[model samples]
Each structure stands twice: as structure tokens, then as C-alpha cells.
Target: MDATLWKNSSFLKLWLAQLTANIGDQCYSFALLWYLLQATKSGTALSLLAIPEMAAGLMFYLTGGVLADRYSPRLLMAGTDAARIVVVISVGVMASFGVGQFGFFLAAQFLLGVFSSLFQPARTVALKSILPLELLGRANGILDTTFRSIRILAPMTIGLLAGSVPLSALFFANAASYLVSVFFVLTIRDSLKGKGGSTASKLTLGQYKRDIATGASELRHTRDLFYILLFGNLGYLVWLVTYNVGFPFLAERMDQGNGSTLAMLMGFYGIGNLLGSLYMARACYTRHLLVVLIGWMMQAAGFLLLTGGPAFHWLAFLGAALAGVGGPLIGIPSVTAIQVKATDANVGKVYAINMLMYTCCGMLSSCLGALWLGKLPVERLFLVSGLALVLLTVVGLAVEKRNHTTKHHSLDL
Candidate 1:
């Protein structure tokens, strides 16, 4: 871990932009989710809110990857940021004018999700370009810590204003954050530095198909990386879907559904994430496989704890904290592994594919979990989540052992 990460002005600028944008995203989400729960008190409604965004990701994620490989990431990022600012502010203004229809918000969310999906591949590739390969883990850890810390403060801010301020105000604040992010992105000088794989080639249909095929080939051959992407992110899906639906429903049942209470719940989770990521930044681990396995189990434990959280507020808090700690343990290493495995030419496509998988799983969880909300108890759902993680961890361990022995046997032969 290089202590001089701050010395790279370009990386710092990119990091700051991401931090600000993430903070704004948290604020916008906290405000909108709390508003929906207050208005409809339906788990289905909350899940429905995220559908458009996920749909957009599903539709455009691969295309975004293609664009990232073809053009300058800095320009792509800036364009998306500008579009996001316009769309977010428009939503805020429309809300202020009493156009408070849910459908209207849905349209806004769709646009936001589109720009967000487009931005991700560029952002991932840009970050890789800005830092050395040796420093990737620490860089990922530090960034994760900062991002989680922002989540803590963003929710806290929403809590503070829940009763006193209009929810629409947060939307405008989010637009302002996008404007700030744009400025920082424009300041970056090397968006094209990592353009070795495909420079100056026109993106024809044939070329696009070839690039997709190439990326798929790389993933198929890299078994370790492939397993991590497929199995490791299952935890992310379960955690995201269960918590997003369960927490609010549970909080509302306990009469703690107000913005402030929700803030406390999310804030504690953020604190746990921040602390865990900080530790990851300082510690060096030779066995990423072990780290990923432990992280999944830890998440399982946290979800099990959360099953009892509504009955015991302290238990829920503890559950949130545990889940937070598990976040960086799983996430940072997965990202670092992907970066390490991908070559310069294919990194954008690989990252896009990764995001595509993540969003697809998240969407399925949200939709299915929403439908199940009425039939299954939230506690039961959480219990199932815990069990699923346990199952995944065991499977991952078995797979690792099988692969390890096969390699050894091959060497002996």
C-alpha cells in the first residue's frame, strides 16, 4: 500500500468527484425512499421505485462498456454528469410545481439510471488508469471507506431535515453535487492514457461483437475471476434486496419509520463499513479467496442477527454494523481481482459485464422480494438470506479446494 496515493492529483480529483456524487446519491435515495414509505407504506411501492433504474442498467450497461472502450472516459463521464444534473434538477423543479405524480418520478429515475449506467464503465476504467497496479487494493479500500463514511453523513443529514424540510430539496442538492463532480472530472488530464487495446478504431457492429466475444473469452478462461464474479456478488444481491425492502417494513412496523430512525439504522451500517474498509486498507492479505469466503459468512451472520433486530433494537443495530464490516471485505477484493485480471483493452468491457451482472441480480431480488413481501414474513426472508450466504460460502470453499487439488495434480503429472 503506497502512502503517497494523495500525490496523484488526477486520482485525487477523480476520487473527490466520486465522493461528492455518492453523497448526493445517498441523500436523494434517502429522501425519496422515506417519502415513498410515508406515502404508501407498501414494500411493493418501494421496490417498484428501483425497477426503472435497474431496467435502464440492464438495457444499456453493455453498450456503455462499448462506448468506454471506443471514446475518452473523461468525456463520457462529464457528458453523463451534465445530463444527470439537468435531469435531477428538472425533477426537483417539477416536484416543487406540484407535479408530484409517482409516474413522473419514475421517468426521472429512469433517466438518472441511464446516465448512471453509462458512467460506471468509464469510471472503473478511469480509476484503473490513474493508479498503479500494486496500489489497487489500498486505493479500492480507501475509496470504499470514504464512500461509506459519506453514506453515514448523508443519511444523518436527511434525518436531521426529515420533518423540517421538504423532500424535494434533497433532489436539488443532488443536482448540485453532480455539477461539482463534473468540474472535477474535467480537471482530470489522462482519460485516454489506458487506451492500448483499441485505439482509433471505428465501433462497427462487427467490431462490437468481437469485443464482446473477447471479453467473454477472457472471463471463461479466468476461472477464479469468473467464480468470484458469479458467486461473490450473490451476497451483494441478497444484502441489497433484503435490506432495502425489509428494513423499512420492519422499521415501520416498529413505529420507527421516520427519516431520523431510518437514518440511525443506515448510519450505523455505514460506520461498520467505514471501519472495515479502513482495516482492509492497512492490512495485506495474500489469500483473496479466503477473504471473500469469510466476508460472505460474516454477512450471513449479520442477516441472521437482523432477523431478531425488530424485537431488539440493539440487535438490529448490531446486525447493521456487522453487515457494514462485511461490505469492504467482499467488495474491495472482488474489484481488485477484476482489475488485476483484466488487460488494458478489455477492462472496460469486463467491468461493464460485472456491473451488468450485479444490476441484473439486484433487479431480480427487488422484484421477487417485493412479491414475496406479502406472503413471507420479513424475518423469514432474512433467515433465508443468512442461509443462502452460508450455502454460498460452503460452495465457494469446496470449489477452491477442488481447483487447488486439480492444479497440484496437474503439476505432479
Candidate 2:
């Protein structure tokens, strides 16, 4: 990792923008969850928030991806941020007026999800434009570590403020964060140049449909990429289930408050992620594919320990740390690989599909885990997650080996 990338004005601007936006997102999430709990006090209502938000985000991702590839990422991101400011302000106004309508909150969340769907793909594509390919891993590591580190402070601060501060204050703060992000994003000149030529002249619903079809066909033909996405999605599923179910269960068993231990464990996890990302930034590796595989394996091992035994409190911390470490190792590489390997014309669609798969799996897993919580032991949930990881790893390794053998044979020919 070159320290020089930090000096690159474009990269610094985008990085700062992302950091600001993420902090605001964390604050909003914490505030909203607290608001929901205060209003309803029902687990079902709180869980439902994830449903519409996740579904709407996934449903729009492909469209968002298409737009990202066809247009300027800087413009797309700025536009989305501007839109979010409106939504956040509106929600803040409604909440300030003592409007406790669940439907209104849900609608606001859905709209935010839609904007997020568009923002993510465009932001991802913009990263490639800012940093050299050789430095992508390091850059991404820095980004992830910063985000994770902030998670430690953001949620608690939001919670503390929730008591005395009006919810509108948090919403206004969120809007301000978006404005700050947009200002920084506007400073990046390269992202404004756009990729490929404008397809607006020929743009139509049919053109989008054709693009999706073409992108899907290309993805289907790329078996290695497909498997990578599949394993990644599965890993997301397991992680989501463990996070949603196992934490509370373990907390109950330990006689600790439901969220206290989990929060502490998460702090340790954040530290681990920071450390792991730092290591990856400096490590010499030809490709991150191996790192992705290893990361998943470690995540699975961590889940096993987290869900394993009553005596495994220490194990839970270790597991959380491992899971955190595994994330950036896999995430940075997988995203960079997709961006580099996919045709620039279809990168948005590919990234959209990737996000949809992961989000859908996570959503589904959360629902299932919620449903199964009463019938399943916490340990069993961990065991199941570990088993799923092991299966995914075995399949990935087998496929990778075959690909290597085929390459060697082709070279001999």
C-alpha cells in the first residue's frame, strides 16, 4: 500500500465523503431502531423494518447498477445524497410533530433503501476511478477499517442523544452528513467524466432488459465468478442468522443484558477488523481470491465458537474478532475482482446482481432465524452456520483446483 494514495486529492475527497455518509447512516439506523422500539416495543415490528428496506433495495439494485454504468458515478452519488436529504428532513419533520405512524416510517425507510441501492453501485464503480488497481486492496482496507471503527462510537452516541435530543435533530444531522458527502464527491473530477459513451439517446426499458439479459448470460458463463458470488451469499446468510439470533441467546444464557455483551463483543470484532485490514494492506499476494476463501473459513470457525458452549464466553469474543477480520479480507478482494474482471459496460449490472444476492440471502436468513429461534438451541444455530461454511469452503476449493488443473493443461497444449 502506497502512502501516496492518501495524498491523491480525488481519493481523499471521495474517502472523506464516504466516511461522513457512513457515520450518518449509523446514527440514523440507531435512532430509527430506538424510535421503533419506543413506539411499539414489539420484536415483530422492529424486524419488519428489515423486510421492506431489504426487499426494496434488492429490487432496485439492477436498475441502479444500469444507471451507474451508463452515467457519472459522482453525479449519481450526489443526486442520491440530495434525495436522501429530502427524505430524512421529511421524516424528521413528521417525527417532531409526534407522528408515530409506522407506515410513514416504513415509507421513509423504503425510500432511503432505494437511494442506498443506487448509491452503493455508483460509489463502488467510482472507487476504481480514484485509486490504482495495485492499491485497491489497501484503499478498501482503510475504508472498511474506518467504518468499523466508527461503529463503536456512532451507535452509542446516537443512543445517548435519543433521550434528550429530538429525533428530528438526528435526522437533520443525517441530512447534513449527506450534504457534506455530496460536497466532497463533487470535488472528484475523474468520476464526473463518466464511463463509456452516453446511451441516453437509445435508452429505453427494452435496452435495460437487454442489458440485464446480456449481463446475466455473461455471469452464468463465468463459473468461477458464479461460485464466488454463491459462496459469498451463503456466508452472508450464515453471518446474518448468527448475528440476529445467536447474540441474544448467548446474552440470555450468560445472564447479561441482551445487547450489552453483544456490543462489547462487536467492539472487539471491530478492533480485529482494523488489524486484519492493516495486515492485508501490506501483505504481498498475487491475487485476493485465496484471501477471500481463507476469510470465509475463519468466519465459519468463529461462528462455531460463538454458538458452541455456555463456557465459551471467551470463545465468543474470539469468534467475533475472527468474523470481523474475515470480512474486509473477503469484501475488498471480491469487490475489486468484480470491478476489474467485469466489462466496464456491464460492471454496474454485475455489482447490482452481487448486492441483490447478498442482501436477499441476508434478509431471508434473518427471517428464518427469527422464526426458528424458539425451536432451535443457540449452539445448534452456530453449528449449522459452521456446517454451511465448511460445505461452501469444500466446494470452493474443489472448483479452484479444477480451474488450476485446466489452466495447466491448456498451457501444456
Model 1 superposed RMSD (Cα): 3.4
Model 2 clashing residue pairs (backbone) = none
* Candidate 2 C-alpha error for residue 290, in Å: 2.0
Query: What are the runs in model 1 whose C-alpha is more than 4 Å off?
Result: 30-46, 158-169, 191-199, 248-265, 307-313, 374-378, 404-413
Give candidate 2's error at residue 281 in angstroms: 3.7
Alpha carbon deviation, residue 153, candidate 2 (Å): 2.3
Q: What lDDT score belongs to each candidate, Candidate 1 first?
A: 0.80, 0.79
Q: Write the per-residue lDDT of candidate 1 for residues 1-413, one digit (tens) a residue.
A: 56578888888898899998998888788877876676667777776787798889888888788787777888889999999999988877875665646787788899988998889888877888888777777888888888877776677677887678788898888999999999999898765465643466888999989988888888889887888787767776677777787777766645556666666777777778888899888767645666888888888888899888778878888887897788788888877777777877777788878888887777677777767777887788889889999999999989877876787899999
* TM-score of predicted structure 1: 0.86
- Model 1 residue 94 CA deviation (Å) reads 1.4
In angstroms, the error of model 1 at 24 is 2.9
The per-residue C-alpha lDDT of model 2 at residue 261 equals: 77
Q: Compared with the true structure, what per-residue lDDT tens digits does model 2 show for residues 1-413?
A: 67777898888898899889888888778777777787888878887886677877778999888888778888899999999999998987886787788998888889988998999888888887777667766777777767776777778777787789777688888889999999998878755335633544566999989888877887798766666676666788777878767777876775556678767676777877877777776665544456777888888888887874468678888888887788777777777667766776777788899888988888778778868787988778888888888788877777777876786898999
Instruction: Please state the error at residue 109 of candidate 2 in Å.
Output: 0.6
